[model samples]
Target: MGINLQKGQKISLDKEAGGGLSHIVMGVGWDAATGKTGMLGGLFGGGGGNIDLDASCLMFDEQGNQTDAVWFRQLRSRDGSIQHTGDNLTGEGEGDDEQIKVDLSAVPANVKSLVFTVNNYTGQDFSKVANAFCRIVNGANDSEIARYDLSCQGSHNAMVMAKLYRHNNEWKMHAIGETGKGRTFEELLPQIKPHL
Candidate 1:
């Protein structure tokens, strides 16, 4: 079992992986928090449909500038080091709603940080969602590393959930859990820059 992290917490990935960590999967999971309907039809007044939450990663260099991004529209990064599993239209099932796989060893040397985010692509905010969480898993062994539960329910449409950054040549994970309003990663750039 891995540590259950809280907002603003930081954990050394190299220490947890015994300093040989090369690959990881950032998974975001959630379920619609509809009341009494037992379904997510017309819950937010947006429409009688499910929430479409998207998982995305923004790659940045040491200067904290965006070098590349991997999201629903662009499934892979320029260097093929990061890949998005695809968009999850409905926050259903028992596991992750979306997953972003990253090869740490393959990431360009200039790249220093990877910001993982979840956004409400359907314009519905998190107040209509529940059980939201972001977790890191060992891609090689299928073991979990750490998990941060997004327990805040509000009208925000997006979240700058967490990030994996380089420190002393080692990678560390930080639980940001900062809420924002955006339908895509492009709009959240301003909010994510501070954390980088």
Candidate 2:
């Protein structure tokens, strides 16, 4: 069980069992939205189609400068602190479509923040996506800590979903469901800057 988070919500990464959370996993999932059928559907291959959503994490130093990125193009960070499970071409799974595991204790000291993002790799806008969600979990116990869902339909193809950052010597997760356009992380960088 986890706290169902809304856009702009923030939670401290303190463990309930009493110590700092050493490992955390960020999970993102989504499915294609059901669209019009009949003539309109026929025009677009009958409405049902796979949505390829790519989950990515960008690490930033104290100055909000990106220091490392973990995505399909690069599976792991330079310091091996963050690792993307793999790419999910279709949002057909029951749980997280893509997972990015992070060893909080292993993260470099200079790295002050980590932003998690998702982009439509197939160039489809989020109006074609449904049930899209982003979550954080305590890896050691496999317990969900917080989750955010992009429940509304939109025309954008990417989003700066959420961020995990160090504050007051503790980690915190912020729900930043900001919509943008990009097929990859590089293209989304500019949009992400304002959110930093």
* Predicted structure with the largest lDDT when compared to the true one: 1
What are the per-residue Cα lDDT tens digits for candidate 2 across 12-55? 87853246799989998888776534677757675456789999
The 10 consecutive residues of candidate 1 with the worst lDDT sum are 36-45
| TM, every model | 0.93, 0.92
lDDT of 2 at 163: 85
The ten-residue window of minimal lDDT in model 2 covers 11-20
lDDT of 1 by residue, 1-196 (tens): 7789988999999788666899999999988875725444455555435888898999999899999999999999999999889888998899888999999999999999999888899887787788988899999997888989985878898999998999998899999999999999889999998898
Pairs of residues clashing in candidate 2 = none
Count of steric clashes across candidates, in order: 1, 0
lDDT to native, each model: 0.88, 0.86
lDDT of 2 at 31: 81
User: Can you tell me which runs of candidate 1 are displaced by over 4 Å?
Assistant: 36-48
lDDT of 2 at 35: 53
List runs of model 2 lying over 4 Å from the truth. Answer: 15-18, 37-40, 43-48
Error in Å for residue 121 of model 1: 0.5
